[model samples]
Structures are given as structure tokens and as C-alpha cells.
Target chain A: MKSEARKPFSKDIIHIENIDQVCNDIIAKLKMDVTKNLQRRGAIVGISGGIDSSVCLALSAKAFGSKNVLGIMLPEQDSSDDSRHLAEKLAATYGVSTLIEDITKALDGFGCYERRDEAILRVIPDFDKKVDKAKIEIKQNIAENIPAIFSITVIKPNGDVVSKLLPAREYLQIVASTNFKQRSRMSMLYYHAERMHYAVIGTPNKHEVEQGFFVKYGDGGADVMPIGHFYKTQVYQLAKHLGVPQEIIDRTPTTDTYTAEQSQEDFFYQMPFESMDLIWYGWENNYPAEEVGKVMGKTTKEIENIYKSFERKRKTTEYLRMKPIF
Target chain B: MKSKNDVKTEIKKYILEASLSDVKDVEDDALIFENGLLDSMGLLFLIEFLGETFEVEVNDDELNPKNFESINNIVSFVNNKLSVKV
Candidate 1:
């Protein structure tokens, strides 16, 4: 059998052509999207002090003027201590007007933590609600072509931990409850937007949006998604070019959803963002699994499994992309 | 004012508008969230849609997945609320 000729996948394009031009283009589009289409006077963004939100705020300020952009620091009980400070610092640097909305009350009214704790108890019977515990390391049978088996590990008080595969009902309960954070924030943003007649901006990048890393109507709800077309790596480039604070850019990407410190990699994506990006790009372009494995320094089977997981995640989370059943 | 069938039709319309998946032909008894056709946020939208279109208030206690899991369930929920009001 003859080998098929491989198409060139230039990693440089990932760098993107003239980062400044791309930034300007996004700014222009954001302006048009709000002014012409939505007829909104300004933009409201929930700044988590993450690279994505930082870059989004910087772009929005440039697009609609610093005064026109409202940077909201939406911190809940589970949010990190530094998240609010970092968000405030970024807003000050960007000259955007900032407001602090502590959503602890809202989340409590919805019984967010109570419902989430109930799910945790199902997996780890001995878990103490007062003590901080986290769930991680979901293993999937991608190559086996099975419905993905979800497992979560809970860290305990005495440094002992427990891990177990989650039953479907229990997993959904935990996720559904935790989703309150995003939804509550979305509702608050809309309240401000409705009062001021501004548009709510979302900060999800291409990888997060495509991989279903966001909760629907929560973080995923937005009047405008300014950077959804760019990958995580590319967003960093824009961050650097736009002069986002080094500390903000240097800080690692985190879910900040759980009480414990959890990196985005731990919560989602089996691999690091860099590797996931390339493999995702290659897989989308039909690059052979073996060839991608060679580049990523992985065996063919491992690459195939990662590719399969990527596909599985996208298929299962397709509902996030829907409008509503009309 | 709309009838029960009208409420169901409008609810279905909003679900279609909000969902990007191909759930148009799904059965009325189909489990939506379990099958990944709708999620928590989607459920929120469904609740709000029902409240606004049918003029019924959805309390915090009634926000169960079962009530919004299927078209049949939603229709039943709306009918029940309407009867209660009358």
C-alpha cells in the first residue's frame, strides 16, 4: 500500500500573523458586534484575573473606550483569595471601571455548596463538608469505544484520600450544583447589563469552548464572545502584546470552581494545554495518530486514545453549543 | 391567553431556539439531560421560558431535573401550574 502525502501543518500559524493586527481585528469586530448589531452602548465583563478575561477586558477597553467597559469581579466563597486582588489590579492597569460583586449570598440562596457536598458524600462517604476536598483524574476508555467512565478522588483531613468511579446520577448532581457559580454570575451580569443597557462579554477561548470546558448559561452565557476563535496559546500572545500585567499572564490557568487549588489541566484536558492544542489541531486536520504521537513523543496508541477522548468530549458536550429547543 | 397545547408549543420553540443539537425529532418521553440534549443552564432557560410565556412563577423548590427532563414532563408541569392557579 502506498503512503498518503501529508499536508503541511505549520505550527507558526498558531503564533498567528502579526499579533497586533489580530488584536486590532478583534477590537474592530467587538465594536461592530455591540454598536451595530446589539445596539448596546458598552460591555460588561466578569474578570477572573485569568489570561482569557484579562485579554478580553483589554480588548474591550480598546474597542469601546476604557470608560465604556465595566470590569466586574465576581468572587464566590470557593474563589481563591488572590483572584479578587489580581482582577482589581488588572482593571486598574487597564483604566477600566471596576465593581466588586461578592456572589456568596446568591450562591447560598441556590444551595450551591449544599447540593455539591451531597454529591461528594456519595463518592466519599467519610468526607467532611468543613474540610476542603477535591475531585480529579477522570479516566476514560476512549479506545475501548465505551461510554466514558468518570472517576473522582477526594482529599481528606488526615491526608488520606478516597477514589471511586462515579455513577451517572451522582456525577451529574455534583456538576449541576457546581454550575450554579457560572449561572449566578451570568444572571448578575445580565442585571447590570439590563440596567445600564450594556452587553455581557464572555472570555472562553477556542479550546475551552470546543472541548466543553464551560458550563452552559453559566460562564458560557454571553452577549458577545470576543476571543472564542483563538486558541489558549494564541490568547497568551495577545495578552503579552496588549501589555497585560506579567503576574497575571505568568499565573497558571485554574478552574477556581472547587475549594482546593485545581489547575485547568486537572479539571479538564488529559494533557497540558500546549500538547492538547497541537494534537487537537492535527487530529482535526486528519493527521495520522502515529505521526502526531511522534511529534508529541508519545506512542501511537496513546495519541489515538487522546484523540478519541477529544472526540468523545466534543460529542457529549454538543448541547452547550445549542440555542434552545425551538 | 394561550391554551395548554399553545404553552407546550411555545416551550418547544424556545428549546429549539436555545439548543444547537439535533433534538428536533426526539421523542416526547426522551430523557433530555441524561442524553446530553440539555444541561443545567439549558434547564434554567427552559424554566424562565415557561415562566414568561405561560405567566407562571417557578419557585426555587420546583427546579428539579425531572420536571424539565422531557417535553411530556414540561407539559404536565405547565398544566398542573395552570390548574393550581384556576
Candidate 2:
């Protein structure tokens, strides 16, 4: 396909050539957003020694400054040594403050017991029953079965006393706990930003933002998304351009929820990043999942599923993409 | 007989369902957040689910971390909130 096959989302031109202009415009808008909304500048980032976060941190450091940036590192107990090392290394290199908190403690404290590690068919919930569907994952033995993985935590109420978790199931209980961690971090980040006077920097990319991949009010939640529009491929490229370590470039990305062996794709039925990325880029670019999947030689069902999910998320994340509600 | 027990059992069923960690033997004092247990928001969602499900209202102050640290705490907190609301 030709480069021109897909047109830009808008004529606003948030391109690399004018990155500085775009960033400045974004900051001005954020400042204005805060002023108009009567909010403060606070940014929280889950810097998982990964390319996306590395790039996001670097850019955020420039946009806001090192002091305004809060780098949260949540590693599953068994997470690869490299990710933690790279995370701390990246933080030290970029001058962003860091927090090394583990989710395992939360797992044990909450009375969790994992039996089955995987599932063939998972329960699907309908909104009618008011059934929180994601909670079903916590029912099985998967909690201990899966190693803790990577994820951003934000807890509310008492941000200082937030809970961490094993990133396993027991959905409502621990997800709320873990989510509280994410939300807590965010809450604290926002509070600190309000106190310190800075905007919150979200690390979502075009792919994740478009896919509705992030849990609502979780990692997907951010006051100012610095790199939401960048594709994952673009992020890696940008990270490399910015001289990010090579190991982070090749390391597998995980939410740091389960054991270190888990990855971001574990819940997605083993979808590969390359495949998911291409399909995601295609859909985001509006190539039509069928057409893009056909080009990629994906199965008809896969294409159909991709289209349905893409459409659903496009609608869901649309609100996020727009200027804040204020 | 079934009124309280049924309510209690059903509540347990739902807690197990809503929780992210497996809910086999959670006690009253289990520290949900510190042990990497139920996140605070997850607890809130569970609380919201309980309130909505049982047609109860939990005051903001009652949603403190202490009440939701374990299954027993959750049950007691819910029962108390529900009874008070009733």
C-alpha cells in the first residue's frame, strides 16, 4: 500500500517535523485546559522499562520538566531483571523520579488462591445484569498460577496507602485493589500536580488508545496524553532516535500483573505485537479491518472480530481523544 | 433462616466474582491492598456493585480502606451499611 493510502486523522498536523510546535501547542492548551477547568498541572507515568514509556518520559520531561514528572514502576516479582534495571536506568538517565513498588504483596494480603492458570472459554457479561464481567478472572486459580506482570496502578481516597496486587484474577476484589493502585497513583499524581502546578502526562499510544485496551479510569486515564497519537512502531522509532537502550527496544511488553512470564498479550489470546500493531494501525488509519487483514492474510474470523472490536473501541475511546469534557 | 444466610452466601458469591484475587479463604483482617490484594478502586467497584446489587448506600467515609481489607470486613461493612440505610 502506498504511504498516501491513508490520510491524516485531521488537518491539525501533529507530525514529527512540527513536534516542537505540537508540543508547545499541547502545553498551552493544557495550561488553558487547567485554567478554564480550574485544575492543576500533574502528570503520572507508568514507566515500564519499555520503549513506549521511555519515549513518553523523554518527551514529558521536555514538555513539563523533570520535577513535575512522577515515574511509577510496578514490576511483578518475577519480572525480568532487565526491565527493572532498564526502568531505573531510564529514569536515572532522564532524571525522572522513580517508585519501585511490587504487586505481589497485595496478592497475598487479599486472601487469593489460584487453581487454573488458563481458560478455554471465559464468561462474557452483559450490562443488563449489572454484572462486572472482568471480575470473573479472579474466580479461578489463575491468581497464583500466573506470575505478576507489568501494569500502572492508581488508587484513590488515601493515595499514600494504596494496595498493590499479583495482577491475577479475583476480578472485583483485586482489580479494584490494583485499579485503586493505578487510580491512587493517578490520584496522587493529579493531587501533586495540583499542588506543584503541572499537567498529567498519559502514556497511551494511538494503538492502545484506539483499541480501548486500557481499563477505564485506569492507565487509560490521564489528564494530558503526550504520546496518545503515536503508533507503537512510531514510539519505538522515536525511542531509538532519542537513544533509548537497545534491550528495551527488544524486550517483551507486559502489564506486570501476573508472574514475570506474563505479557500484555496473555489476556488477548496470544496475539503478537507485530500482528496486533499492523491490524491496529490499519484500523486506526481506517483501512477497514477486512481489507487490512486480507493484506496481512489474517483469517476471516480474525478480521471480522478485529473490525467489531475496533469499531466498538473507536466509539468508546472517541471521548478520550476529544478535548477534555471541561 | 435463609434470609441472612442466603444474603450472606450470595454476598460471598458476588465478592468472589468481583474480586481479582481468588476468594477461597479470605479472613476479616486480610490487608487487601498491602498484600497486593484488592486494589482500592477495585474495592470501590466491588462496593458499588454491592450497594447497587443489594440496593444499599455506602457513605463516602465508610468506604475507608479498613472496612474492605478482607471478606469478613467486606461482609460486615456491607451488612452494617445496608442495615443502617434500611
Candidate 3:
């Protein structure tokens, strides 16, 4: 068989050269998808003050008109105050009407906290929910090409910290209970969307959508996802092109679901978005791992390991991307 | 220290219990994860079992999948760690 020539792999491969054109294309698609396909009057976006949501809100405003766009800030007890503040600033910048819905009470009613604490206590017998903050993180690096081992960290009121490997059962329970936060927010978004006859705009980027980084039927539920095609790095590019606030653009992406303050990198993704975007692009395009490693300043073995990790994640989370069974 | 046969027997037993797979179908060289025997969580449980049962420390750096992809590889990894401790 004849050989097929491969495109040269480099860090610049993921860069969006014409960001304006890209943004305009996304806006055009969003307009058609919402107005014609979904039969929605406007767009409703849940703004978290993060780059992805901020960019999505900006796109929605441009596509559906600022007055027609509604930005909802869903803050729970564990959410950082900066998220709400940034979200408010983003809405104001776009001249969009905004609503603040605190889901703490809803989560509390569902026993979200109680159920999570019960599981945490299974790993840490003395874990106190009221006086302690907690977050779960992967202990091993993804480059190891082994199964991820998750450990939960608890911070005491006095600043003492404790961490322990979470068993499978406790880990599942904690994650299931915490997922109520996302599903609740999704329900609230749909409520507002239905009330206003607007499409709910999802904020996940290509990585989150393809890698199954989002909660199924929770944050994953949406009428339209304008930025789902862009990588995390490309999302930042769109944010910059849309004149998103420098502060929000510079802010590190976070899970924002835990009280203990965790970055998306530490919780998942395992590498900086810049490197991850390039590596994923190269892997997806079937470039030799050596070529990708050379550009990313990593060894060929490391690149191969990352490829394996990505494959495993895609396989495991395949069900999340599936549609409801007939 | 336990002999190689004893170490393999214990590891095989734990793999069977953790995976809940039939013993007759599982071979020494069978791929533990690829064959739907153990999952990510099952791997962690096996690591815990190795540490407690054999007093062998499995460091984060030593977590390469090649070292634990199959029952044979896991036996070799555990034996190497046990030898290092001595």
C-alpha cells in the first residue's frame, strides 16, 4: 500500500489564525440552530465567569441580540464568590439581563451534602462536614498510563489538611451525590429556558465534550452548544476576540464544584490546556507520537502514554455521549 | 518472604475476588483490564491489597500499566518490589 503523507505537527497546529472568522461562523450557526431548528426566540446561558461560558454568553448576545440573551448565575454553597462576581461582570459587559439563583437550598433539600459526607466518612472516619472543606483529586499522573487513583483531601477550620485514597464504593457515592449540583443547575436552566422560550446554551468546549469531562444529563443537557467545537485553548482565543474581560480570560479554569478550591487540571485533564490541546490534536489526527513529543518538549514515551490515557477516557465515558435508547 | 508460587496464588485469588470473574477462564497471561476483569477502581483495590499483603510499596512513579497489565506482569512487579525491600 502507498503511504499517506501527514501534516507537520507543531504547537501552532491548534491555533486559530482567523479568530474573527471563527467567531462569526459560530455566531451564524447559533442563530440558525436556535431560531429555525429549535424554534426558540432567544438564548439562555449559564455564566460561570469562566472563559468558556463568558465566550458563549458573548456569542449568544451577538447572535440573538443583547436584549434577547439571558445570563443565569447558578451559585451553590460550595461555589466560589469570584464565579458570581465574574458572571455579573460578564452579563453587564454584554448588556444582557441576568438572574441569580442560589441552588444551595435545592441541594440541601436533596441531602447532597449529607450523602457526600456519609461517603467521605467511610474513608476518613473523623471527617466533619460543617467544619471542614473537601475536594477529590487524582493522585497519579496521567502520563503513567495506569488507572487513575483518586484521593480526597479535607481541610480543617484550623488549616490542617488530611488526604486519603478513596475506595471505589465511597468514590462512586461521593461523585454521585455531588453530581446533584450539576443536575440541579441543569433543571434550573431548562426552567428559565422554557419560561422565556429560549434555547439553553451549553458552555463545554471540545475537550470537555469529547473526553467526557462533564456530568451526563446535568451540565451536558443543552439545547445548543456554540463553543463545543473549539478546544479549551481555542475557547480562550474566542474569548479574547470577543473582548472578554482580561481578568476572566486570565483566570485558571476550575471545577468550581468543590468547597476546597480545585483546578480543572488537578481534578482532571492532568495537563495544562495548551499542551493538552496540541497533544490531543496530534493524536486525533494520527500524527506520530515522536513528532508530537518533539514539538511539546516531551519524550515519545510520554506522548504515547498521554495517547493511551485519552483512549481509555474516551472508551470509559463513551456511554455519556450516547443518546437515550429507543 | 513468600515463594513465587505463594505470591502468584494470593495475587490470583485477589484478582478473582475483586473482578468477580470465573477462575477457569482467567489465565496467568490474561490482560486484566482489557478482558473486562478489573477496572480502574479494581486496580486501586489490588494495589492496596499488594501493599498490605506483601508489604511492598507501589510508588506513584512505578504505576506504569505495563507493570500491571496482566497477572504475570503483576506477579513480576510484586516480586521485584519484594526483592528490592530485602
Candidate 4:
């Protein structure tokens, strides 16, 4: 807390000299801090088989050796096959001992927590039963009581049926849930890092920090992100230089935010990355709205509207700047 | 063409194949995680990728954030591994 005294605003202004020095200087100083602060604590980072993490892990394994890093795959049942494949392949490649725990049950385990929660999950099972010849659609909204040992289901009278109320694979809480996965991995990484006096590292890229694309107190929670300063595209170049998998580099990047396979960009901006990246740069560089129109082939008014939409984002980016120094 | 640096360079080539992205000009210091560039699992997979590509190992305890912040950091990390007494 004492070290975090200065709260610098997000820089739309990129200094060439700072850029050159920051990457090395930041990593060296930060690594020393991570290694020294936690003495034996090592690092935990999840690799979703995407560009950023690939870049991050390459560095982590290099810093602490593959023997010290912990790679965990916490995925929901609806997770894409590529998700599992990428995690498994990446882990195998690094010689880092790995663990794959399917948390779909944990998510569904929400029903086991509370009586009302169970009742909410106590929807009409797909079972058919005929009782007393009174065909009341009682199975529609059946309520269930949780008693540790078992769930007691009570049929509702004429209640509207809960139609496929499965937990959202990736709701707004998807980002939060994803962050939870990272935090959970950290929980395990630190356990070993501390036991062995290894340091824990975080994985973040440059664009996200500048635009404030993460959930505050969620993914934002970390010991430190070694790759937090690198841009999204730069991470790819870095990853290539680091020798990640060919499959990973070619895939359309996705957090698999939903069962529908929506990516992070889609989940966050509801737009394709190509378009978003273009607009993001123009907005940050103070590219005139009219100029944007020319490049994007949109009318000036449309570009201005787009600019206005990002105006709030630019201001909000300040909120995600350096942690307060107090 | 057939040296430790070659292997390291090859490993770099594989790692760069990843598909994550950011909204801004993909420069350094843009917050990969914050920008939705990579998630926890993606980070894990990259660890696997490195094992396969570079034949280096990342133990459970050494996955800290400092070493993987950027390309330069990653290169430094790999250099350490290449130099480590196997």
C-alpha cells in the first residue's frame, strides 16, 4: 500500500523512450519484488491458449523455470474443445506439471448452497408422472428445499415452467467468473510458490490497462502482471518470438464468454476485433471524427457518434490507472 | 540454424501464434488481462506451448507475472532457462 502512492492517469500520450525502457525496467524490478516479497512463493497463470497468456507464460517459465510455475485449467462444461486442447497442449509443452479441474459442477453446485437457491434450481425435471388423474402442470415451477443430505422438491400449482434456466455460461459476471479462474489459479500458485519460496506473476496486456477493459477488483487483482504493458498485437509477436503453438496463433481469440462462443471483444464491445481495434487507435490518437469516417468509410456524423460513444470510455480509463498511493 | 538460440527462436515463433487481441493499438503497457487479451486458461495453455516449443519446464510455483510482461521479458526468461544447469 505504501508503494502505491502515485495515481498516474492513463496515458493517451505514448513516450517512445518510456516505451523502450519500461518493458525491461518494469520486468526486472517487478520480478525482484515478486521473488523477494514472497521468498518461496511461485507464480500461477492460466493459459486459455490465447495470445496474451501464451506471451505471459513464456516469460514466466523463463523467469522461474517450468518446475516452479503452476498451470491450472478451470473450465465450465460448456467450454470449447479448443479451450481444453490449448490448455493441455501448452502445459505439456512447458514441462510444467498441470491440473485440469472442471468447475461445471461447482457452478451447478450453486443449488447446494441455500434452500431458496435450490428452490430456484428446482425446476420441473423432464420426468413424467400421473397422479390422481388431475393433470395439473404442477411440475412447472417445482420448489426444492436443501437439506445437505438431499433436495426436497415441492411441485407448484399452475406455476409457469422455468424454461431451461441454466446458469449463463458467460453472463456479465463472465468476466468476473473468468477473473475468479485466474484468482483460483493464483491461490494454488501461491500455495506452492510460498512453500517453495517462489514468486507469483500476473498476465495482462497494454491495451487493456489503457482502456480499462477489466473488472475492477476482479481481474484487476494480481501480485503483478509481467505482460501488463505489452499491446495485444505485440503479445502475438512476442509469443511467436517465444515459440508458442501454431494452433493458438491462428485461432480467432475468444474467452468463450458464452455457450455461443462469443469472444472477449464481442462480450465487451459487441463488435468484431478488427473494427474495434481500428476505432480504439483512432480514438486514443485523437484522430478526428471526420478522419475516422474516411478510414472506416462511415459518414462524418456516424464517426462523430462513434467518437462520442468512446468519450465516456476515455474518461473512465482514468479510473483504471495506477493504484492510489494512499 | 541449429543452436540453442535457434530452438529459443522457434519457441518464440510458436508463442506468437496465439490469437488474443486488444481494442487499442496493441502497443506495450495496455494491460493484456485488463484489456481482455488473455484469460487465466490462456495463460496456462501458453505454459504448455512453451514446454512443447522450447523443451523448458514451468513448475507450479514459478508462474509469476514479472517474467511474462512483454517480449523482452520473455526473451530474458528464456535466456535464463537456456543458461540454467539442467
Q: Which candidate tops lDDT?
A: 3
Relative to the true structure, candidate 1 reaches a TM of 0.75
Query: What lDDT tens digits, residue by residue, belong to model 2 across residues A131-235?
Result: 111212111111121111222122223333222222223333444544444554455556555666766667777767775556566666677676677766656
lDDT of 1 by residue, A1-326 (tens): 22366545545536676887888999999999999999999999999989999999999999999999999999998899888889989999889999999999999999999998888887678778888577655453233322344456777777786766554566778889989999999999999988889999999999879988898999999999999988888898899999899999999899888876778876676567787788888777778888777777878887776776677678768989888997
When 3 and 4 are scored with DockQ, the better candidate is 3
Q: Mind giving the per-residue lDDT tens digits that candidate 2 earns over B34-63?
A: 444444335545655665577655443344
Which lDDT tens digits does candidate 4 get at residues A109-216?
Answer: 442113222233333343222210011111111011100011112233444322221122211222344445444445555565456555555566765666566655
Best by TM-score: 3
Model 2, C-alpha of A266: deviation from truth (Å): 2.3
Better of 1 and 2 by lDDT: 1
* lDDT by residue for model 3 (A1-326), tens: 12266558877887899888888999999999999999999988998999989999999999999999999999998899899889988998989999999999999999999999999998888888888999999868777757676889999999999888776678889999999999999999999999989999998899999989999999999988888878998898898889999999989899999889899999988888989999999888888899888998889999998988787778778899999899
DockQ for every model comes to 0.02, 0.02, 0.43, 0.01
Q: Assess each prediction's global lDDT (C-alpha) against the native.
A: 0.79, 0.54, 0.88, 0.52
Rate residue A303 of model 2 by lDDT.
62
**How is the predicted docking of candidate 2 categorized under the CAPRI scheme?**
incorrect
For candidate 4, write residues B1-86 as lDDT tens digits: 13556754654454445533322344444333334444434444555566666666654234444555444455567667867835
Q: Weakest 10 consecutive residues, lDDT, candidate 1 chain A?
A: A140-149
Q: Candidate 1 at A178: error in angstroms? A: 0.6
Chain A only: list TM-scores of all candidates. 0.93, 0.61, 0.97, 0.63
Cα lDDT tens digits, model 1, B19-69, are 765555666787665555665445645655776678776653354445666
